[model samples]
Target: MARKIPFFIQIILIPLLIAAILLVELKHPFPKFRLAALVLVFALIVDVAILARGKTRNLMVVLASLVFGLSLAEGAAGAITPRSVVKIDRGWSVRQPIMGWGPEKAGTYHAQMIDPSDNSIIYETNYTFDSDLLRHTVSADSGPAIVFFGDSFTFGDGVKNEETLPQDFADLTGGKQHVLNLALTGYSPQQFLHEMETSRFDKVIGPDPKLFVFLTAAWHAERTSCKAYWTAHAPLYALEDGRVVFKGDCNEGASLWWREWLGNSALYSYLIEPWRHKVKHNDVELYVSVLEAAVKMAKEKYGAPTIIPYLRMPKEYLQGTGFTNDSIMQRLSDSGAIVIDASLQKEEAAGAQISIRIDGHPTPYANRVRAAQIKAAIDEKLPGVLLADAK
Candidate 1:
């Protein structure tokens, strides 16, 4: 007679074996204890079947063990699949490639090159708008200053520190203004409003800033509704009493963190996004609402001059792309902010041109032109403030 299997072994083995299968899908690693457990369970099942004289039971046991074992091993391998980790700084974590604008104009291949402008190389502030910074930028600040807000274009994606629009403004004005570029990459207007309310730039400088300059590109209004934009880019939140609460996961690489680093391959987007809007919600309306709210908040709560500089593209260039609508322009005008349409105005006959050859962002030369535009607007809209500061 074959040896009898222990009752305890059967109970433990059955559940563990089942669990192992489930864990395989999760791709969790297996420790040595699990391997030994599997071996013992298989041996016990075979022995028990033989002792009971269960015909073909041994075959069944052997097949089950082999299948389960292979699955577990595969899961273990997946679990061990290397993950790239980025160290996050105080009050925020910027997951590169996670929530960023899809790859460059050319395209990415098997070798996914991180955008040179991304923070993976340089630890810039808005590269990844983590929870801490997001919370603080909108919160109350103490002093008078200039708060500059918007998406990547305002965040200085391709440009360096001193070359950003805000920096250019500060430099041109002789640094009299405390200019904070609160813009974040892949930022929706809602996110910008959140940053405005939560992060208190005023505290660092003074009370409500003298001016609130918001720079916007045409595409930001549409891309705001993207699910990948929401998931990978948005701040963290947890369910609290059936309500969502911002937990602000400041830790770099927590096990609970669930974010995809390698999103849709760039090649896929090049082929797809241009053809399809690929958004779940009405981003245009949402963008309009956010802008309206921002204007209201800045005027009523902060008492600052608000400016929305519109980066206009030629109709020919925007033909294939879906950004040709005048809705955003209408919204900017309706919001009561100064609208500086760069493309509409002929390049200043006197000054150097700042247009980018390959991309939409303004070049260093272009930033100077933008600075001139802002100065011109300030002179017209807030002449008293400009004159007082000049003195």
Candidate 2:
């Protein structure tokens, strides 16, 4: 005798699951994901109308097997998986009229990094932003403005308010150059290009910049390619007739369901994430084009040399990942970028520890090392600016 399907499990529970999936699709609709979601919903509907009426016992067996299997898998994975609870200061970002998300607000926030192993707080500091949404530079803005651009490494993610690269550079040079830090956390080179393309360039920066510095990372390849999930709302670019052109934001037709669903899952993070990261969207050619375009524009518009700190090849990236792209450094150099050696030597790395324990982000001492190298690059690449500042 076949057992009847339970009203609660099939009629209520399965429908609820379908509803949740539909909601996610509505929120972040990707074409492929929507088709798959619709197919899954159809299967659930079939089970309710057809399978539930006839093969009740078999359906029950399958449901029970999936539930039991997933429970054991999730539990086993959770035991070994690194997890941490985060309490962030809200209202840090303001939504742009376009798809982009803007800067951190001008306020102080209690920021801390936690050890996932023992749930201990590694360090706590206040992150303070200025009226322009930049981290407060250690020195006042007065001299010829030297602008720094990149992600959090340039923004000093886990360091003190005054321990950033721009601040360290200002202090290293006796505050001769007025530092303008325009880097935001989770930003890519795309944002830098976007800034150069828009009117926000003149509005955000007062007067002409003395120089432009970009801290490129290996992970930035994924960021500019729109492979990183955090870049879903970031500006997107494409090459047209060997010129970089703005397309749209990353959320347009982006397939981010895995990141939305299983990103935090240890099993998924360890297994599937690597598989997906193997192939990039448009690859580094597009990346270099965007960079080259920004460089050309900066030279054409502001007559300032764009300095790209050579970071891809010499050592493992700040996040402990190696860049497999061979021509990344050479390409930038060929594109007329001032690529400098920012990688720390063994003795310097020993004294300065390349990364913090919380994540593989650069330490304060490491920033100072890079800043010193950058200042040297500035002296060599933009000697005119150096002479002007010295005058």
Compared with the true structure, all predictions reach lDDT values of 0.53, 0.69
Regions more than 4 Å wrong, model 2: 1-51, 55-79, 85-87, 93-99, 253-267, 279-282, 313-326, 348-351, 387-391
Could you tell me the C-alpha RMSD of candidate 2 in Å?
Answer: 5.6
Work out the TM-score per prediction: 0.55, 0.79
Worst 10 residues of 1 by lDDT: 105-114
Q: Whole-model lDDT for model 1 versus the true structure?
A: 0.53
**Global fold similarity of model 2 (TM-score):** 0.79
**Poorest lDDT segment (10 consecutive residues) of candidate 2:** 314-323
**Model 2 score (lDDT):** 0.69
Compose the digit string of candidate 2's lDDT tens values, residues 219-263: 676777777756767888887888788988876443455445555
